[model samples]
Target chain A: MRVFENWDTSLKIPSMFLLMMSMALIRDQYLISLLPCVAAILFIASGLPLSLLLSRFRAPIVFLLFVSVFLVLFSEGDALVRIGPVVLKSQGAILALNTCVRVLSVITVGIVMIYTTPLSGLSGKLKRMLIPHILVDIGIMTGRYIMVIGEDYNKMKTARKLRGYMPGKSMARRFGVIVPTAATLLIKGFQQSERVFNAMRMRGYGSSAAGEARSYALERPSISSFLMFLATVTVSVLLIVLEVTVETA
Target chain B: MHIPDGMLPGEICAAGYAGTAALTWLCIKKARSSTEDPARIVSRASVMAAAFFVVSWVHIPLPPVSVHPVLAGLMGILLGWISFPAILVGLFFQAAMFGHGGFTTLGVNALSMGGAALLAWAVYRLLNRKSGERAILISGFVAGFAGVSLAVIFTGSVLILTIPAHIDAGTEISAILAMAAAHLPLALAEGVFTALVARFLLRVKPDMLL
Candidate 1:
């Protein structure tokens, strides 16, 4: 898919940076939340397709359903429906609705951020943030190699399937074989890494980057955007505090 | 176990964030002493990262919930303190990329998930070195299951601890119970999956074991 192509390199950094900052801005209440939700809506409205974006959130949506349905249907509140042992309450529904909205809002904001920033930028940003370079580098390599190993696994699976290797009553036997195969892949990956490391050493890999990589300047924040973000967070937090206080009173 | 944003009470989240940061600082300090060589450091970090990356994505469906093996313990056995950074990195990316978790909760996830790895490392050191195979596998199982269960319990207990005093007793109990119930299958599945993956790793690269 076009969206997936060079996706990590395209829009991961700025989006992630924003996400991190925005998270800090979110308060315990609706004021901070409403901003992100509204921002997500506006972001969706501007050019991004909501359906396509929502499609990215299918997993979270399913999880929300399973986790929240019981909570929403059982607790006491304004009665919506009651069938013998089952009781659906308005309060419960509202609780479920709020959770779903929060989940969607987070997912939407993440999707937009990822779609616009590059993966390299995310790591670069982390390094800039004074996060340990070793951690950042390890994360980058892991993401890169997981895809590598995954592709290797998929290819092996296809080859095995071609040879009449089907999972069935002989599942244990197949599993036994899969272990050795996966090990071989692990060894192969290690060997490859060794060679790559050697090559890098010969080329003086760490010598230059060691010094140059210490710091990178952060992006300049726009005054208007910063203020808007602050306003959203403040208002959302207040609303949530007010709601909880009123409910208790 | 990733705790997404807004999933729990604000107080619980705040407390978790604080607790997580303290533990993470301790882990990082512990890791600092062992970073004598660039090669060793890089390999340990890479392997831990690779293990976590592999485990995070390859989930199996178990009826109501889904689970992937928690290689945290395995990572610890193989990579020691380096697993800390690897985990920190993994949790950060998961939050930034997936929004399956929040930025504020990153430290908490790393501590809960990575803490198991450190614990596994400590436990492995206790068992006979000859039973390294069995030790690693068992450590993996214990850490995997414990990681999932403890994280949930910790998260749940935190909620209980931080509930606003004004919240009714019923609302408090139900929320706590709901959180606990939701995590039941995940713990079992994580334990089983961890055992299998550990077995696979042992067979493939016995050298991976400490």
Candidate 2:
């Protein structure tokens, strides 16, 4: 856990990205299945609670199962199993398995990357990676205010509930209630933005290069971080090579 | 409609990133060249993006189920060209905060959703030449409907076309159609919601509409 947390964002971001892309590129079922095992190992190494990962896994797992069921039911191949009037094809089953493995592996890697890294470091890393400064600044502000806006919505909902506002059964009535609430939120948000812009101007934001200079300063990657990044890139290249070899065989 | 990571091929994801980078650069350039102060634009767009993100949490009951409004069209009508960057920011926060989407698929998701917003904005601007309340509501409804429908089409096409499987072409088409059919109700709901909100804003705070 400390190893990943201590790793420099410069290397960590690209390493995780390569790992995910490798998982996506692997076509052979047996080779693809190895990734989830690797992800499990990484998950355990992260030292986060098993429940946290499980909770995050719940929605995607359900979605994967739904997709897999569709593939098994609709795909064409020699019939592998008979259930009443339905036929499950061997090809469909393989496709379903491959899809599940690939999706799960990629999702697991994403979860590990997100959970292990501090988000505060993300904007900086993105900037350093040459992402647009405006996009990064907007991203930072948006991240900072999602909770604030969400809390405001909650308060408004509570106020409405206290004032005997009931969401009726009809869709029109529901829209009636929702539209006003949404309009008010937008209005407040617009007004708040003006205030925020004024405050930023007062602080000399955008008056000079200082605003750009205030971006998060990233630390240089350590030797160990570089080695890990190299290992990740090598593994990714090997996975692609093996996938191509299996395909050509 | 957020495409999860691993659902797409690495090459497709890479292409998505490439396309998104170009579009984002264009948007930033447009924003910087605008008459409005760049900082003010960013501040307003960011805060409004946050507001829209919260608004999406409002669930509309459709009997046995409920759906959240994407509000991409409303965002387009309000934020203009800044809608794309605001949406990109909003998606990033959603992916990071709740894992609702994947980091690798960010570009694809942004393009689908943000592209819809741009289309909506164009439609609204074209139809909104008339200076009447009726035109505003009608254009708003059309924009909203078009936005979500286009997003659904883009997402369905991407997912159905890109599934690394042996499913026949017939099955793929049917799957795409099925996905579109499933989201039709949500699209209609968003259309009505956007129209009503546009009308409300015009009455209370007209400038906020654009």
Candidate 3:
């Protein structure tokens, strides 16, 4: 949870925004697609531990291995082993390479965003983007409650195990508690919100007061890095376009 | 699974993008009509988004690959048709934050998952189980499994429909078929997870279901 604690408390919102922007760019501009991945790598190299980045990458690599191993062994690349009537096309290797590169790119882009931004800052930005205030508030509450419910969940499991609630219990029976538990969790959560709201009201903190706090300023990206990012996106797009044109012709 | 960007074909991604936009618009319109207060509508939308946010990060690696909660069916039973926006937000965040799924395929993933949620709601209603608990679980399983399977079919179809007429139709068909076959287990896993979570919600917060 420590690895992810920073993720939730610090990295959630900004990374999400970056990811969305990168996704949009990847969809349309070929060059922009490359920037997030490259920039992410640079970010990791500068400050983040290389080991952590490598581990983040290891998940997709493992998944990719399963699919590609099948292709490499049975694939007909130059008829490497002519097993009776089968012919392995060299094209299979080419396809696998593209798939691997594509997956890595996607993973790296995600890593970059996570490493660079914090969640509060991201949500603050979204607030300015005109997403409904209520939704953001709910999101904040949800974040707070995940930890709360998660703690309750652990306690329940521990107590059950101590009392001999092991694997022998029916799957149906084991899950039976989830309903009431969720109900209690949410009702409590909602009740807490109501209480907090009322307390704020008593202290003169309601709709208008909350609105004033919402107008705080955000940190802008450094001008040099921003321009460099722009240039990288431009070059990457041009390269992709060149590749596509060459492939088509 | 969230399909990362660049892994999918451009035309297929475009179709997903367009389809998802239309669905979101429809969901917003429905949200407006269903609720009396703007705050209530926003709160309902956030519930789905919040559920999705937690679901994406709880990945349990089953060896070669990692899997997490799909929660489509659970969201459907708990939130009904409103699961659409919830799931769309979740998918959007997952792609953005975790890079689990790509941006281009957002529309397709949302439609596929949202369609499944709606389908579960319909099935649950058809069963007419007044108990609510049993109905929620059943709906969750059906919605989760069907959503994943249908999405695979949709993805394969997208690849086929746009693979250009001359690129050996047979090869494209075979490839998509293989991909679909490989995806069957993942769908079943999603169904089981959805059911478990639905049951959990039923136990912990029965009020959320309504």
Q: What is the TM-score of each candidate against the true structure?
A: 0.74, 0.94, 0.70
* Global Cα lDDT for candidate 3: 0.55
- Per TM-score, the best of the predicted structures is 2
Candidate 2 per-residue lDDT over residues B1-210, each given as its tens digit: 887778788888888888888888887778777845777877988999999999989886666788889888999999988899898888877776666767788899999999999999999999888877899999999999989999989988988788766778988888888888988888888888888999999999998876
State which candidate has the highest DockQ: 2
Which whole-number lDDT from 0 to 100 does residue A227 have in model 3?
A: 53
Per-model C-alpha RMSD: 5.5, 2.1, 6.4
After superposing candidate 3 on the true structure, give the runs of residues whose Cα lies further than 4 Å from its correct spot: A1-46, A66-87, A127-144, A169-222, A244-249, B10-15, B47-69, B92-99, B102-108, B126-141, B155-210
What lDDT tens digits, residue by residue, belong to model 3 across residues A1-249? 232323332223334434433333332234434545664654554466667657666545665665454454444346444567765445455555655665566555555545555565555555665554544554554555456545655666577678876533454443344433433444554454445545545655335624643553344545554554555455445555655665566
lDDT of 2 by residue, A99-173 (tens): 888887788778788778877667667777666667777888887778888889999999999999988888778
Candidate lDDT values, in order:
0.57, 0.83, 0.55
What ordering of candidates by TM-score runs from best to worst? 2, 1, 3
Tell me how each candidate scores on DockQ against the true complex: 0.31, 0.74, 0.26
Off by over 4 Å in 2: A83-85, A120-122, A207-218
Task: Tell me the tens digit of each residue's lDDT in model 1 across B1-210.
Answer: 466554555445456557765665666566657654454455556654654565456544565344554556556665677666777777766665555565545656667677767776676556425554676566666655665666666656553444222335676677677776877677666655555556666776666655
Q: Every prediction's TM-score for the first chain? A: 0.69, 0.90, 0.61
